[model samples]
Target chain A: MSALLQLTGVTAFYGAIQALKGVDLVVNKGEIVTLIGSNGAGKSTLMMTICGNPRARNGQIVYDGEDITRLPTFEIMRRGLAQSPEGRRIFPRMSVHENLLMGAYGRPPAEASQDMEQVFTLFPRLKERMAQRGGTLSGGEQQMLAIGRALMSRPRLLLLDEPSLGLAPLVVKLIFGAIRELNRTTGLTVLLVEQNAFQALRLAHRGYVLVNGAITMAGPGAELLARPEIRAAYLEGAH
Target chain B: MVRDAGLSALVALGLFSSMIGVRMTQGDDGMTLTGRGGALAAVVAAVFVGRLIMLAWRARRPAGTPSPKRVDAGLSRIGRYVAPVFLIAAIALPLYGGRYFLDTGILVLTYIMLGWGLSIVVGLAGLLDLGYVAFYAVGAYSYALLSTTYHLGFWTTLPIAGVLAAIWGIILGFPVLRLRGDYLAIVTLAFGEIIRVVLLNWTSLTGGPNGITDIPRPTLFGLKFNASGDADTFATYFGLDYSVTQRFVFLYYVILGLALLTNWVSLRLRRLPLGRAWEALREDEIACRALGINVTITKLTAFAIGAMFGGFAGAFFATRQAFISPESFNFAESAMVLAIVVLGGMGSQLGVALAALVMIGGSELFRDFAEYRMLIFGIGLVVMMVVRPRGLVSGRTPSIFLGKRKDIAADLVAQGRG
Candidate 1:
């Protein structure tokens, strides 16, 4: 499959300290590519850089035949990219339905409602808590709402940052299962960042291991999962 | 708990000693403690005793147990009827009430308009604008200058002034597009000062400190509210004897209509996508951008629309006074309007109107208090903040709801994150 997103020599910084150092990565169309890393490993930094928040100090980020290296975050989102950011930053004051509607802020109303139905189908709990305040939701439900909100944008490339963080084993399984199902059925391209290395690698088609602001390994997900060094470093005792 | 009460007593002592201990008299022996010292000590002792009682009460409650929920059914049930009843009373006031009450009503309505205008920026959009009075100034000056130079009527100048202020809002909005919270507040405050300084310096255009005078009052169609004018006066046209109260009553109704319009438009806009965008931006701006909302456009619209309303109020103020000056639009005016929004509870239209009534009417009632008016007002504000830190009406109903509409408690909503 042709590449849906390609980042070359991407360098990013926060103040004087560098967060990403010439990181190279690619996500092919109709594939789930996971980036596995520990905390403080520049995974979120790369995600934010791709969205042009603290933009890449150097390098090229091409998405769907267009250079999006310097596009503003909202502009990047308007170009069919969406991120379910870390910490599930749902608008606390907004109801669950309003938060979902916000995800379709840039789309036509009719199509947005259609996407909303798809999201509701994926997370029925969200439908049950439709009128509840976002802040009042439980941790698992809030994560589902965050994912549902991102899905409402109908993004061509969905970038998820630590989707399974702090979730129960069953909820994590459900989230990862949904991600895999989304890719399989709709050919939705996903670039997932996860601390749960074993589960992420199992779900993705290809995987990249990032350490200390640089990629240490890249290969097919099965090959990386089988590596003795990767097992010792990341997958030790992980379910 | 004993130590806490002692600390509170000490603090109260310091506060009361400086603020209420001594009085300056007109006699040769100017400074006199008199009986005020005893009163101050009594007040301090009362506060200390109150704190001790509160501490004792808290100690009696078991730890780690949730407080019992207070039933809010009666209050909300009453709230459903409050608005219609208030509207009827306001409409009937001129028929029975005398001239003084009508004047106070006009004053209260003006503040309500200003409070609503500021609410869009501070409450909905989460942009802290301490320079809102700048837009008010722009509107007043636009009306003052346009009417004086071109002899435009109040009705004609009203919209032009609003547009002019909106343009200024855009102008101010552009430079501070990236600032948020405290930084945004400081910049807006400076912008307000800049406008006032310009008005003070631009002597020829704004008439300097002397201000523009003899500006025409608003008319009812072609009829003026005066004894002698070229066209038929309001009194003559209606075939009633001329009374000064007629003008005051008319002005009161005009302001009441404007305030009601502000409330209606604000409520309508809250349900629209743009208004939802404002609340979303207020909640978390980065998430708004992630959701493909143009933050700059949202911020600009909030500022411009808010300023437009401020301009309308300013124009009305100019016509009401029949004169305009820089003194009317100042930082204190901005603070007062901002206070109304906060005290009313952010993003609640009814809260703003209630706050404006209590704050403005309370100040008006304390007019006879003279030098002590501001002191009493300060104490009232402090007590309000202590009693209800989130303002009087802390519950917020979400604009869009799927099942049944419910008011979200104030603490449930994010606080001042922007």
Candidate 2:
């Protein structure tokens, strides 16, 4: 598969305290890639840098043969890359539908209703609760809404940060299942970051192990799942 | 001694009236008579009768209980809408006064219009614009320069001045799009000062603080407010005396028209997609930017529109004053306008107008208080903010329809606390 995105020597910071340090990674076209790490392991930071939030102060981020490293968050978003940020940073005051519309905010503005319908098709539960304020949603429902909102942007690659975080086990399973189904049916590429490595790796085509702001290991999903270190750090303690 | 003197004076007036067998014939012509001491007598008599009726009515009602005003939510909303009109409609009263009081009323009206202009900036956008007077300055100066040097008519210069202010608004919007809150306010305040300094220093164009004088008054279809008044034309052309009240009525209606148009345009804009976006952007710029709502465009639109209104008011003010000066659009003027908005409620339309009246009218009315006037004004504002920090009209609700209320994210799952 062709590499759709390439990040090399990417370093990011927030005022003197470093979050990401010289990380190199690649995401292939039509792939579900998961970066499994603990909290504060630079997973979310890496995602933010890639999406041009804190901004990639150093390094090159090439997406679809264009350098988007220096672009503002909104411009980067317009270039077919979107993120469902950590904590499900959905617009709390807006309705679920409005939240989704916000995702496609810069999009042709005319295509919003059509894009929202697609989002609803992908996550029907969101359709049922479209009128509800985003904050009113349960943790699991909020995660779903956040993912659904990102999909409204019709991105080439959807960056999912902790989709399963803080969710119940069944909800985690359902979210992973949805991820798998979305990848297979829609052919939508995903760069997912998660603490639920076992489930994330199971859904992903490939996986990278992010340890202290750098990827320590990279391989196929099954290989990561089988590794002794991956087991010790993630799967061994879980059911 | 004062009480005794007042009773004796009143008794003298009564005897004087009785000696002449004074009578009032209620008609259109009697309207003129009412102005010359006749209305005062009638009003005093009416008040006495009204007080007696009120006392008798209270006596018939249940004793020992204070009567409530019976204000409901709907009634309160209606009161809010109508109260300003009822309170301020007495601008019509000044027709009975000399030209000086009518001029005073005109000044009050101009301030009300200015307050409405600033409301769009600080009220709707939530951008604390301290340089609003700068836009007013721009408009006035633009009109003065264009009208005198270019020899343009007042009507032609008015729209041109508004356009020029809006252009300045856009120019101002470009630099400070990234800044917010206190920093933005300080920058805007400096901008006002900068404009004033420029006008002062740039001696050629502005005439350097000496100001432009002898500016022509607005003419109505080639009929000047000179000896040939509206009534004179109507009398000769139609063989009927339109009365001098026609002039007063026309000027009153002209301002009324401007105020109404401003209200209409503002209200319409509020309902548009742009206004809602402005509110959303105000609430959270980060989210708005993230949503792909161009922050620069939103901020520029707000400044431009608000400045346009300021220009409108400024043009009106120039014509009203028939003189232009940098001193008129000083930092104090900006503060007073901002104070009006804050005291009114940032987002309220009517609140801004009422606040304007209170600030301007209070100052004029308290001219008797002299040095203590501003002291009283300052204390009243502080006390008002303490009583209602949001504003006088802050209690007003935003919309008719309600949105879904957020439920707290609490688990029904029991935890062992006991």
- Best candidate according to DockQ: 1
* Model 2 ranges with Cα > 4 A deviation: A13-19, A86-101, A106-110, A117-151, A161-185, A195-203, A221-226, A231-239, B1-113, B221-223, B228-262, B271-273, B362-365, B395-418
Model 2, residue pairs in steric clash? B123-B346
lDDT of 1 by residue, B1-418 (tens): 8889889988999998867876666667775555478878887898899899978876786654322224234444666788788889899999998888998899999999999988999899989999999998998889888888999998899989999999999999999999988999999999999999899889989988888998888888868899773348999888888889989998999899888888888889899889999999999998887788899989999999999999999999988998888888889999999999998888877778889999999899989888998888798888777555666666667787543323222322333211
Alpha-carbon lDDT, every model: 0.88, 0.75
Highest-scoring model, TM-score = 1
Badly placed stretches (over 4 Å) of model 1 are B1-7, B14-40, B50-74, B403-418
lDDT tens digits, residue span B303-361, model 2: 99888878877777776677988889889999988998888877777777778778887
Indicate the residue-level lDDT of B402 in model 1. Answer: 45
CA error at residue B341 for candidate 1, angstroms: 0.4
